[model samples]
Target: MQTQLNKHDMSSIKATIPHYTDVFNLTNTSRPSETDFRADIKETMVKYVTFLRKNDAPFFLSMFPIHYVNNNSLDFDFAFMDNRSSHKVNDGNATYTNAFEFLYDSCHWALAKANATSVKIVIGAIGWPTDSYPGANVANAERFYKTFLPFIASGKGTPMRPNQTINVFLNNLSDENRLFLDLGSFQRHWGIYKFNGEPKYRIDFSGKGRDLYPSTAKGVIFMPNRWCVFNGNLDDPGKVEYMKSLACSESDCSSLDLGGSCENLTYVEKVSYAFNRYFQTKGQASQTSDDKCHMGGLGKVVPNDPSNGKCEFPVEILSAENVIEGATFGASGSSRDRVHGRMSLSAGLLALTVLWMIL
Candidate 1:
């Protein structure tokens, strides 16, 4: 008699638990970025997956993201938006800029090495914070839930990983039951639930799971997390002291250039700032345009309208000011329809007003 998983047993050849792995340390890890631990685990899993698929055995794997760690330590000298950049700090942390690419490569390599088709991988943790951090307010938390959870959910099957769902897990369901968000060497507030035990109202990952138990329990939906709230103020004196060794050099401050422009995200505001010696076009203070968004590149501009779709100004002719509205994860730019964008001040005001009225 042979075990159903007998054929897939690389156990004889493979390493097992703790395995010096970040097993119990989903929020913490030996590696600072996704780079340190690459395909070793995936390659090992791939072998098992291939064996299982060939032998016709069911296999399930849980994948927790380096959600809290990036290639660089959180930089305070930089503005908030500089979170994306490609440079690396002397410390092990990867810069947020190059971090995404690193994540993509590692995941892709693992999937490929796993040579796995039948084996399923689920992204067991992920999310964004609602408040700015510290206050840990419910409204901010809820607003983030509104956007973050769904974004992770929406990113379910990447263009490459289609058919491979990275099921995110529900909040507070941490296998280790870690109530705290323990990012590697960084301060974190990454749980979706309040310290007091109330759930943020935005995401339904867990509640929906009561119905979804069978599917996810069996590996259908992937990557479900309530939220991750990391709010160490760039100005936080504590972080400066705590994360000093992880800090960048004066040459590598925030993602800003010597003149403060996003090499990739450079927009009219930065451009305008450079040329005019001030941050404005004519008399209007402009909203900084984010790199990922393109409202309508000049193609939509009419003959006299001037925006020739090249993003170059039409030479100040017959102009209404361009209101750079920042980036959105989706086209509508409406918080109601998308995930991962900042909330409007009006909405904040409305939420406050409602709270005031309710109180």
Candidate 2:
């Protein structure tokens, strides 16, 4: 897979091996002619994926999308590369809107080119991160992953080729990763193994894995500097301790002032690194909840016990039936109560059984 830069700069690392997959590190500044870069991409396409079409040998290619940009993502398209995308990629001028635009456009262009030559290509590594970003929310993440990510894996092709699933492995969840020395591409990933390094998204393709091989080919496309650590070895206990203390607390959180320090970064940071909505929005006051009785925006939420002035979410109003039929994410907190009730009943039944045995 290629780690091509954004629309402005298209200088991709030329592939050395004809059979092996390589990373492409995308994201460049403005250019006079991005068309030339597009040409470069096409030329490479003609040489590699198309060139080896005659060979019967089975091979796989994979990639990672460090940048996944879309405000709504409903009409997201990959034609933004040269602004040939079907959607309104441009607002007014030549719009190089976000990094993910390149990815989406490049995907379409590459596949179409391959088709022109009757070349067969296997799609790989498409997914959405399931955490908050500067602008993205948990709802969007869940929607994107649960619906869109699976759509990629399901392959939106013909019914006969239903088994021919495309590959879209997620980051942070698939492999055993390590903390790098932060020597290259973009940022440093200190806790690469955020647990077992399991893939953020999992796919069950009914035993057919493009032959169904269970592994991702690459990540962040071409960004070597994306998530590597430096100097203080992560394996070092003292270093980890100092890093955590300096990074987590407010007293020594000055590291944030610097362009690249993990100071003040949270676990949530690792979950959704480049998302737009990860940071809290400006001017929006946090929900300063005092026992729920507050002005719901402009109107006052009158409490049932008016003297206490403490309002609660109308649990009785939001019944299990209401949640199941009306809620965006199926039955809300009521499921917890349902489980508790079931457990209580089961416990009572067990107690009666013991009493019967004693009698």
Candidate 3:
């Protein structure tokens, strides 16, 4: 890749590899000389840094203070950028008030040990999730970025490299409902905006400490404001449980887990949430013959909103078919033909689902 870039006269494009905070054994925070890269990572970094130095490239690293606090059972306040709690870390003359700076400088120490102190560092991904775990909420995410962004904008580098410019990129722009859950359910909730392109909370992206929300996407089409809820029929508890499991198996139910937004919901409410989530994702087809809300006749579509406090029962947006149809309306014949082909494929899938239900 580097050779190709150089051949194309694009040597200015730097190559970077992402790494977590555990790249080094930061046992002695007070002494940079004592810090060393992990044994297995040492050889790799030594060889990689040679190329980086030759090309004057930057080292890319990912840092998540929230993960540190959650996995290590550390104080929650320690994760905040402006934290001044009793959990402050002292590294010689430098007093680290937050985990972000501690981890940032730790990477610098590791780079220095690799004999690549000249290589600049760029933060590849850093942001907080808004659900699926304790301390992962809109308020906490907002608080984190509020201080961290300004700190980044201020150009106040870590204790190891003071007053240096650092480049960073936020992890994501919008929530991903279908994201893989290997890392944790929180991975899907890291977006600053909801899946519908609405800002989750106030954020001053300019990093000037202004209380404001980002601009929302305009002209978003949505389904009707109806929710599929579990009827108050508990005669067959086993059937109800089976229906709930089936709904969750085909849709998102992360919010029903411990520490999640809907964790405190009653059993009936939990079942309703699962059913409604599946219904919404199916384009809210309660009125159609292929109704998703019909959980063995235990579900009902209600006009009244089922949302309670932070536990929101969201309405889904218009399906992709509508968007494609609109886009191909006045397009060239070839473009319309291609879109129609895709729509036919979607229709075939729907037909298969309906046939399977009949079977």
What are the per-model C-alpha RMSD values against the true structure? 20.8, 19.8, 9.2
**TM of each candidate vs. truth:** 0.32, 0.33, 0.84
**Lowest summed lDDT window (length 10), candidate 2:** 275-284
Report the error of model 3 at residue 351, Å: 31
**Tens-place lDDT digits, model 2, residues 122-209:** 4334333322222222233333343344345455532213345454333333111122323221112211111211222333333222
Give me the runs in candidate 3 sitting further than 4 Å from their true place.
Answer: 26-35, 323-359
Once superposed on the true structure, which residue ranges of model 2 sit more than 4 Å away at CA?
A: 1-37, 56-108, 111-116, 130-140, 153-155, 158-165, 172-359
- The regions of model 1 sitting more than 4 angstroms off are 1-46, 55-105, 127-144, 151-156, 162-166, 173-190, 195-197, 204-359
Estimate candidate 1's alpha-carbon lDDT, on a 0 to 1 scale: 0.29
Winner by TM-score: 3
Which scores better on lDDT, 1 or 3?
A: 3
**Candidate 3 lDDT (Cα, whole model)?**
0.75
TM-score of model 2 vs. true structure: 0.33
Model 2 residue 75 distance off true place after TM-score fit, in angstroms? 9.2
Worst 10 residues of 1 by lDDT: 215-224
Q: How many collisions between residues are there in candidate 1?
A: 24
